[model samples]
Target: MHGGGAVLELAELAFRELALFAAFGFLLGALDNLAIDLLWLRRMIRRLAGRRDAAPWAIADLPAPDRPGRHAVFIPAWDEAAVIRAMLENTVWRFAGQDYRLFVGCYPNDPATRAEIEAVARRAANVRMVVCPDPGPTTKADCLNTLWRALEREEADSGTRFKSVILHDAEDVVHPEEIALFDRLIERHDLVQIPVVPLPHPRSRWVAGHYCDEFAEAHGKDLVIRDSLHAGVPSAGVGCALARDALGALAAERGGLPFDADSLTEDYELGLSLAERGRSGTFVRCRGGDSQGLIAVQAHFPATLAEAVRQKTRWVAGIALYGWERLGWHGGVADFWMRVRDRSTILAALVLLAAYLAMLIGFVLLIAALATDYTLPPMTPVLALLLGINFGLLLWRLAVRAMFTGFVYGRREAMRAVPRAIVSNIIAMIAARRAMTHYVFARRDRPPAWDKTRHIFPETAVPRP
Candidate 1:
């Protein structure tokens, strides 16, 4: 090839790389704009209005006329024996005084978990344990599926009726008053999402900070936007309530399909499917600190950076491969927009990977040109502005998170955690890329079995008499 042609080809490649980097930057920037303009503003305004202590919109007062109906607290357990007992204990203790029933979903192979759950049931008449017959690779979704089957058979025999179904994680320790909130919301909304706030350890590790950041951004700002726009708010895999009628209809429409079956991130997919199936799912911002909040659920934020990354990686991979195609976003503008947002989130790490490569190449080329006495491309003000704008936006996000998070880890501690979070990002990026690649290349496009996350339960603070 001619020297001139080779140089032209090289220049074309560089331009393409730059364009790809810019495109990713633009997508992230647009997402930032949406969060700030649509969601964060409401959160900030709510703060300014001093409405933090105000009562939740879901329930004005407890013991409303519609509080009493057959409601099932569906807790899907898979190898959760470590925390399952505590979770069930709290569920029973809290609901002991309520007018509803407690149903725990467990796998038969997990004898310890089954036994503990059974003991909890024996202690409380309102509690019952159902075995999930699936011997296939264990997933929370499968457990829920088995529970749904059991419920169906029970309803068939006795003609029992239920008004609502609430999902809770085994690690969760819900507030006593949460039942009332759920009862109130069930009376009005088809689906309702309650805030899942992280209960951070005082001496939390790096992963805890990352979890806190997610909760602050998602629960604090993200839900605010969903409320403002009247769009759907996805559940945090827990504290989600579904009206029994709508749930029954969804199940019937799907030929009595499991509530969340064969999906990695079933909760998220469930929420999206509900929205697509013409159901309204909304959020309620409850009042107070984590301890004083209306619904204080004890959930362990990944104790280590590696665990956090694994969780996010599975989420990104699951959502990208299974959710987007199945959600059917092409049907309408709203669906399309939701898909767009979900895609942008899933692609964030990929975009960053591309941008980093481009920047590296540009840097190496600039250095070689300087050393070789060759003319280099001039830096433009627009490029500088673009870089500054991107950095500023990220900094703004961190700042917003810090402001609302209230007395977070010290600056030194945060800096230590940042690298751990970065490591997590790298792992998640690799996993997401692999999942996406498999989705496009594999002959069978079926989703792999869900790998349950290992929970490191926080040591309970001993109560002083």
Candidate 2:
């Protein structure tokens, strides 16, 4: 009986310690969320107080160019035969009248993707395929570098310089007015990013729909705040345009290779690099001519748990781990704060794991105390206050997430956001584990490989406007 009682006492002690740790973690997370929440509230108050009559810029307000300047769209493909043709066809058909050229990069080993690109190029005069000198499965940045070289050669041969170079992916549904938008905005902004909205999946609401939730909040609120704060706006990898001068400067900085061939998230690094050099980057969100809100890019995200986890693992590895090593801690106060936010995923994942473990232990202790008539110690005032604040902050975060998700998606998806957040948390934990493993290997001098995810393109025609 004494041994059993001793074990019970130890169990309670462990539970108390775990709760304390969780409370500390929750405090940190709540503090971070509070900052963003306060910023958003301030913006809302300012908007309500002052600009009630003025409207944001609409796509229709921009004057049609007398002659469209040459613009290059770079798509780096490797084993993307499944969606490359559809993407190319949609892009060509949508921008039929615009003086834009589609430059596709393919490897010698990936003949299937090259064939798909060639098939689309055969029908579209403006589409061209640039074959890479290397074999298949190289980094996307390497493929982009190959395309950049091809763009230089094309400019030399045709004696027409492209005003801006746009980046996109194989499965993206390009907006009809996106080229025109880039053409107009590149004049003022050295780098222009458009919001990316992930299309809802009919079958995989939890896996794919989580992406919709994230992007909706990110593109809708976070990026807006980032721009307002004058902290850099990072590229979404697709639907972003880089001015010719900006691209040239980047290439000159690295001796002809504009994109970082070694970085997993080169697109993200590119945006920060431009900002570091004092180049202006803007995120444009506007209504299209058809009276519908138009985001620059829309595509299907990973529709399965495995695929989603794999993709997120790559992202975490690139942004949180490798980015810290390469970029270091450089920038202004806002920039440093954003970087901290970006790198906090690993800590967040650990906190989540701790919270779950604590909940399980606490539940067991609650049952034990009821049966044995032994009560756990009362909560301290400080811990109780922290827990209360954490709960409130969590609800606020959920409400913000739901607001953004509902604005883009309907009310139904927004309702699912709360439950779907759990799925995202689980994914984050898994991805964090995988990312740490990859980072460990990388630190030991192992080169990072392209962990590409298979993409899907919707069969039906994409909604335009």
Candidate 3:
């Protein structure tokens, strides 16, 4: 009986401490999120006012050039033979008339991918396969650099310059109007990014559907606000175009290769580094009209928990750890604030874990009190106020998430976002923990290798609204 009393007392103390910590951290995050929401609302109002008179620009897709400017598309592949052929063929069919060329980087060792790309190159006049000098499994950035070198040679031989360069993954199902959209916007911005919609995986609703929800909210609401504020927009690493001049600027400053080979998230850094160099980036979310609902890239993300965690671990490690080490806080006010938001995910995950543990302990304590006759200690006034505010913020956050999700994916998926949020939280927490253990404290001498998850292109077309 005495030991039970002692254990009860200890559990209560732990619960109180955990609750306090979670409440404080979550309160800060809630306030930050609320600020972004309010800012988005202001931007929406201004956009409505601007369109108060003229026809909506979204009714029709952006005008395409009769002879679109010469553009280069770079896709780096390593052990991606399964999906490369389909992706390249689809791209060839969709971009049939665009004045663009495909430059696929393959490894000499990964003959499967090389053979697949080689097959496509043989049939398509504009398709060029770039074999990397290095062996297999080098960083994606290195492969991109190899492709860039090949493009430079082609430019020298053909006496033609690409207007811009687009980055894409092997699994992406690209929009036909993507190049035209970028060409239209590249006149004003150094880097132009489009939305990325993860194809819904009906088989893995919890693991894969969470990405659909998260990206819908992110690209739908968060990035829109960032672009409106003129803040530095992080690249989604796909569906993004960098002005040839911008790439040249970075390459000139970088002594040769524009991309950092050492970084895990070279594409994320590419846009931010350009921003640091006084270049501008924009995130455009526009309708493509007709069967093409949104002018964005669609791809299949990880459909299993293990795969999802593996993919996100690299993201957490790259952004939260390596990003901080390389690109510290050094931009304008909005840029700095956005960077802070990017780095806050890991800490937020920790707080969430603590909150979950606290809730479990509280439930157990409640059972104990109901079974016996002992009353628990009263809550602190500060904690009570914090809890009340947090509860309200939680509901608001969910509603906003659903709204943004439904805005893109329709009503049913928006409803799924509620339960899927729990799955997202769990994956984030595990990935954050793994990131801290692997990248944060690992040996510095080990070279960065390819951390890419296996590719699985959607076998069928993803139905668009």
Candidate 4:
């Protein structure tokens, strides 16, 4: 009898623990959602009422060119053969009249990528290839380091000077006007962040919608809010331009350390590093009518659900491991505010875990009451009202985005992605947690080789329009 009683007590304790944890998680999630809503409100107000010129950081305007600005398009590739040629073609066509040089970085082992780049470079006069030494660590940062060394050597060999180095992934098609935008922005700020949008893929799977959601929130609301308050914007990895002086300063400061070689998402880390060193960032408009902000980049979102999860998981892990840790030390008021933006997935995961446990417990209790013929108190009207308001905020925010971005998605397509986003976020949180834990727990280490995301582009995929 005592043993049975003890067992019951243990079970009760476990349930209580879970219930408390779950409740806390739900509250956290609710708060995160509220934060996003507040950000969206700030963005909308700024767009409607703010002066376009008054905000120096809003958009870049190019000066009339007597002498063209000296710049280089630094494209770093690792096994990107699937979309390299398309990117090159788009880049050349867009920046044809500009005074920019091309530096295509490739790994020795990636023969397919090298061959494609080589073929494209032959037709393009200004494009030059920098082949990095083989047995590379499959990270963009590593490629950047190799490219930077070559760039420094080239700069030494020739007396030529470059004003800025623009970074892009091999798969992205940069907007033609980005050069003009950067020219204006560079006159004021040392670093500029361009917006990223997924290439239009209507028939693409659930990943397309997920990408759209991210681009809308990150570029439209999150960045707009940051710009309104003069806060630092997180790097989109690609589509950003860095002044040559800033690059030199960063390299000098770190000695031989590759800026982004530590984790999967090197672009984000590089952006954060600049801010950590007291560099201010200007948000160049990448979208909207007659606005230079919507510089189109023909890039693919992960086509399969697994690819989406894998890609997001990598971001989650890398941001936690590299971004949070570096910012943890030198973070100021700006950093604190930005943490609310950067920790979206972490906040979402905690909330989902909490809400699920809470409802599960509530349902189980209600079922037991029914089976035992016992009268149970119904959930109070006040509690019901609170829950409804909580969900209302979420739907309103999502609906606002849907209305503007016009759902290229149907009911079946949209419905399928809803649960996938939730699951994908959970996986992302797990990846983030694992990366943070590893970084904290491990002692001395070599560079971590990340699991590569396999491309799932359609067999009939053509260049993005």
How much lDDT does each candidate structure score?
0.66, 0.85, 0.87, 0.65
State the lDDT of candidate 3 residue by residue for 1-465, as single tens digits: 213488888998899999999999999999999999998887777677885522234625344444457899999999999999889988898888888999999898999998889898999999999999989899999999998898889999999988899999999999988887888878778999999999888798779999999999888888888887788888888999998888987888888888889888998888899888889899998776566777899999999899999999989889988999999998779999999998988999999999999999999888888888757778889989999999999999999998888987889999999988999999999999999988757778776899888778876753332
lDDT tens per residue, model 2, 1-465:
213387777776776777778889878887886788788778777765766432245887665655457899999888899999888888887888988889999989988898999997888889999998978777889889999999999999999899999999999998888888888778878898999999999999999999999999888777777777778888889999999889998899899989988888999988988998999988877767776566459999999999999999989988998889888887799889888888889988988988888788878777777777777667779878878988888898898899889998989999999899999999999999999998886654544566788888988754353
TM-score (all chains, Cα) for each model: 0.82, 0.94, 0.95, 0.82
Please write out the lDDT profile of model 1 over residues 377-399, one tens digit for every residue: 55556666666766666566555
Error of 4 at 78 (Å): 1.5
Any runs in candidate 4 off by more than 4 Å, and if so which? 1-36, 39-43, 50-67, 200-204, 256-258, 286-293, 329-331, 364-389, 400-444, 456-465
What TM-score does model 4 achieve against the real structure? 0.82
Note each model's CA RMSD in angstroms: 4.4, 2.6, 2.7, 4.4
- Quick one: best TM-score, which candidate? 3
Task: Report the CA-based lDDT of candidate 3 relative to the real structure.
Answer: 0.87
> What lDDT score goes with residue 140 in model 1?
75
Model 2 TM-score, 2 decimals: 0.94
Higher-ranked by TM-score: 1 or 3: 3
Candidate 4 per-residue lDDT, tens place, 305-408, comes to 66666676667656754556655644666567667557555655665665566667666555655676443444446556556666675566556555434433
| Clash-forming residue pairs, model 1 | none
Candidate 3 worst ten-residue window by lDDT: 53-62
Which sections of candidate 3 miss by over 4 Å?
1-4, 51-56, 59-68, 289-291, 462-465
